[model samples]
Target: MTSAPPHQSILDKPFVLDLFAGPGGLDVAGHRLGIPSLGLEWDRSACLTRYAAGLDTLHADVSAIRRESFESLPPEINVLAGGPPCQTYSVAGTGTGREALEEVKKFIERLMAGDSDEEIDKELRKLSDPRTALVLEPLRYAIQATRSPNRGHRPYDVIVLEQVPAVEALWVRYAEVLQKVGLPDGTRYEVVVDVLATETYGVPQTRSRAVLIARREGLGTPSLPEPTHRAYEAKEWNRRNGDSAAPVAQPTLCDASVPGPSPAADDDLEHWTSMGDALAEPVGTQHRGRRTPFLVRSNYGSSGIPGRRGVRTDRQPATTVTGRISRFVVFEHLDDDIVYEGARFSMNEAGMLQSFPPDYPWSGTAKAQQVGNAVPPLFGAHLLSAALGLPAPAPEVMREPWIPATEEQRAKLRSHGCGTADDCTARCPRPEDQTPPRSTSRPRRNTASRQ
Candidate 1:
């Protein structure tokens, strides 16, 4: 079967700068849509990933970035985009004590260019420049620094913020600040966007995410896009259900009788065929035995299967790609004999579900990290390009890297052997038992407890 054609973005192209741009997924989408894009990420691994995807990635923290960099950036940057770290506001954080919210509040205040002597003093005490603070601190500084004294102008035409669902309050704070900072009235952000998957656009995943779009006056309020694919009209779909909740028509994974979307063939989907294929390589001895299946399920409903499920939604767009690799939907073969069972979708497949092109090589960083960190390039490209009024980008065209026989990957494969991961012919050799035996001594009871 032939591969899908390159994605045609539904937006006018614009120059974009992706701040805190992990792995350049957003940039790629924009680039494909005829927008010139640049990525800035703090992590070296992430920078490498962006470079491989053909983006001009900078290895610098947002806080450390100087105003000159923005001033000197390629003239095409009409948009500034990023997703700040949401650890303090994250529900999973232990730092949620008073100090956490205080820090996050300070961050929001700084983003609005509000000055506080206490925060400045705290930075001075730490022997650090307040200009180089994390989260919103640098973003605020960048905005202020890039402004021209003579022209009295701002640095960007627009800014986009993406974050976790658990941080709704934080987004509200962001919206508050955006309004105060001269964004035209009614330019507020929505914490939750109703987005459907490939089903609407003709792919197949029930993916949902929150999206926030803010722009300058000329750009106007960004309106949501319309859907192209419908569930009942597609012959591949076996079941159909209209969503009363969906503002637009929603798509299905397949049909009710069939479980999920279709799978790509060995040649088309080879990179996602096995567990190890999801990761570039292991991270240290700590991750040596941590292998994730290419298919995973939640109880028995949603799944993480390879190349089967598409994006799902009918209203807004998808959320950023995440390393929650095991939470995506799965696709099982419908044949009498189930060849790959209990499988979860690989990291690369997860990227695709988010609309990343197949030829978008995710490199440098570990596969899971790269996939998790990447913005859905398609979303970024389509959104920002439309905002810029440029043409769409062409699809990726490149050959796979030549794997030498003596390379480490090949050597390891030879040492162990390769076929189906299901073939357990070469078991992981048990290391010399290092664990100590349980202590035999009984615990002595406290005799003086009568006091």
Candidate 2:
């Protein structure tokens, strides 16, 4: 898919500095849209992956790194984008939104009080949860950049940030502060905040993220990008009720790697790509002679946590691709028999689900961690498009007449049950004799807890 030539705007588009640049998702988006970018990451694994992918990167902690250290920084930085580490404010995390929100408020209040940096530092040190306070670092950089005389009169044109939805209140609070006080240059920042579903941006996953875009007064107000694809949950609710109103669903795991889509794939109606398509490898028929391209037996169950109950191709997008993606089980169906082959989706598949290049240079021991933590490049593209005011649209969902794809299709995609998830729950017995259970019950029944 070709993009329009880079838009000629007020600012001479230079490199965007991506803080917390895990595995270059935003950088990939920037590079594709013709905007150069530099990533600042401290993790050894992420840094190695960035350099191996040949993407520009700086291996340093964003808290300590200053823009002046980069001799290559353009006269004007076009964009400042970053997603601060969000473990402290995630659902899977300790559920510390309230505590973090309070801490963030204190920081804002201290800043408003004109408390000295030493005082702010002392206050931050008082928090038992340190990561909670790290969110304020972006504001520090923004304030400093706006006030710096290094770039003559040009202040940073745009600032973008992302975090888990639980942190929306905190971000909105920061936005309030930035809005109330203009930059040192007397230019106020126009702020737009929203929570976006990654699937809507064509990432092949249901990951939802809260985004905040703030631009200093002058370059005009910025708005969040419009949803390009219908969210799967939204489509399912509509389909269940037979409320069919021209559905434009997000590309499913199936569409992510469907090397070649039929030219007439979406002629009459838009169809959501299925799990089978995303897992189909070019070395064989898209489904390896399976009756349909929608059934999959995954190691995970469909019930509790996502990816635990295996995912079926036609159901919903694969559960949020998390750091522990290895827990998923891959099943192979041969003719009339279903075989538990103990296969897992390749790292390439994980990358595709996250919307990275198929051949992205992957390094480091925590490869799965990098993949899980990244913002999908496709989603990042839409965000960049909004920042620069460009049009980034999702592709048409491949239309298929096979309405209500088979029950087996849904079963394979559905989480839990159906013998797809083997040894899934930790409560499943492990005999000292190493003998298989003689009862022959469904391998997916024993559920205690996931490790």
Candidate 3:
């Protein structure tokens, strides 16, 4: 795996802190973009993934980190970036659960203090006394020891947070807290965008998310990058700033036809081929065989099948990549005889769709956990590079050691017939015992077909 450059003028580059750094997707992207980043994660396997990605990783909980550590590090931290655990705000969560809300509050309060000692005083004031929150004593030392009173208190210049669109409103609180920490009002930040990818950038799959950009020194609130591919178009939502917008290019499952002069292209049809069962339907006469009628998968379904359709595939990007395994579907390639034609995303393929490099090293057994936890590196690269004024790199270029399929994962893929053209039976939680009858014996070839 490629590692950070030799220690030379690290001060010239932006220094970033990545909290809850799962598999280091964001940090990897930032590093590729020439930003120097450090990742903090609690999971050991996650830390390994980050290490494989060429980042300076610390295996520790973000809440456990002290301010003294920051004071000891270089003074030029241009960005404080992280997406804290989303459990509190996640749809599956109980809506700002007490623990999550407390963490949020504590995160803000720590930033306000810029160190541990001040944090203690703040806690004392908030609670009856500092002793009441004694369990937080270590954090107090970390904060106090790291604070730089001589440098004047100030938050990082830019903060980039990613989360589900449904819960983005919760972040206004973070913005509010940052502003209260002496940054100029209004100039402090903006939750500039909340759009669905399927409606805007044309990924074959549909996903939605909310991206928030907050800046310290009155830099323009970050705007969504224009789509480069002719495949998808900019959707003119009623809430959009303008009434009329141009059609953006749509990206296929492989190549995202971006709008720039140099649009990136790829023809890896793995996802298309994998989900063929869900997207394709038979034509012609009745009961050809035990073929199931293709069904569209919905993100909200319990069966974990792709079900929504009739939405334009060429006019917009895909939705946010969710962590839900049951909702995302992949097509399966099939050859006659035993029956074939549909498959779901292999854990690795799912990771790729999320914009992790093809070889992103994933840690742990829960494939869903690894894929869902990754930050879309492409998105992260663009956001962090822009924030730090550095040249951005594409997500694919960042390579790592642990990113390739593990032995066990390889066995899973082999079991699923990843390499062969044979029919593979996938795990479908449906109760239907009888397969859908095949209406036709031959496969019809159409260019406009959901390729």
lDDT of 2 by residue, 1-451 (tens): 2222444343565569898898888987886777888777767577656655656665565655653443334556758899987776887664544566876787775665456667787777665556666678777666557545666545567888998898788778877877886554455678889898877666666688999987766666778887655565644533443331221122123321232222254544233333443444432212222223333333334446442344444334666777877655444433344333435666666776677755565677789889989988878888877877666734321111112224444333221211232112232212221221233333556556754
lDDT of 3 by residue, 178-218 (tens): 45553222224433444334212222334455555655435
lDDT of 1 at 54: 51
TM-score each candidate: 0.55, 0.72, 0.55
Off by over 4 Å in 1: 1-13, 66-76, 86-107, 110-113, 116-142, 145-153, 180-207, 227-295, 298-321, 324-348, 389-451
TM-score, prediction 3: 0.55
Backbone clash count for every predicted candidate, in the order shown? 47, 19, 65
In terms of TM-score, the best-performing candidate is 2
**How far is each candidate from the true structure, as Cα RMSD in Å?**
14.7, 14.0, 15.9
lDDT of 1 at 245: 23
TM-score of candidate 1 relative to the true fold: 0.55
